[model samples]
Target: MSDHGGSGEPTPRILVFSTNNISDPGIDLAGSRHLHYPATVSVLAMPCSSGIKPSWILHALQAGQDGVFIASDGEECAYLPDCAERTAHLVTVTQGLMAEQGLEPQRLKMAAVCSVCAEPFAKYMREFAAALSTLGPRPVTAG
Candidate 1:
């Protein structure tokens, strides 16, 4: 209902952790094709989606990002047999901590993306941004 961005910024900013092997390329493809998503989106590449630490997500939220999106490698990840499973578990644990700390668990999201999934990647970003907007902003401090 209120302004979408947590700090009342006009556009909500999202920090995406994309795995290098799969999701990163998908994101790059989205850009090359000029697929329009939110301009406020920022991406960081990771060796693997399952490698993210809970503190990283907390730090991003504390550092003023409106939301954190995990662009998981899906079944294509070379790092782990169950690529999505590990990240999903991390998200679940992190979300519980967030709720305990009075932060909106909805501020964090995750999705599977393969190397050639540019169109789907764009769609996911659009949807995630809208969801973050609805959740408004996240609290600065973590419990």
Candidate 2:
């Protein structure tokens, strides 16, 4: 599905899975600061990035998201010490699954977004939006 919004051009939509304690604050700060990012970007708050299911990533892509970004907690996870490693492993697994399903691996990305990383979050969103635009709209499939 494509949302042209009367512009006659398909806009790239991104689904961001952000850690509640670590990344959500930064994302919210970006918004409060009036930082520019694509309006089509949506954020979902999760307790931890490593807890995200691989299936959820595929589901988001298949459900029409042009890309999925994980706002990881990195080495400063409040819930788990090895959260970064676990999240990386899940990202790898999810990418492999995407490849098997004929999806571009670049469509999935992960980065650290600390509580005070408003600028970085905004930058990441802009970069992801550009990358998705270059990839074009995702091909729709019939269920």
Pick by TM-score: which candidate is best? Answer: 2
Model 1 error, position 66 (Å): 0.9
Which residue pairs in candidate 1 collide?
none
Q: How accurate is candidate 1 locally (lDDT)?
A: 0.85
Point out where model 2 deviates above 4 Å: 1-8, 140-143
Question: All predictions: root-mean-square deviation over Cα?
Answer: 3.5, 1.8
Give the per-residue lDDT of model 2 (tens digit) for 1-143.
24653466666889999998989999999999999877888999999998999999999998888899999998889999999999999999999999988889999999999998999999998898778888886754424
TM-score of 1: 0.89
- State TM-scores per candidate: 0.89, 0.92
Off by over 4 Å in 1: 1-9, 141-143
lDDT of residue 12 for candidate 1: 67
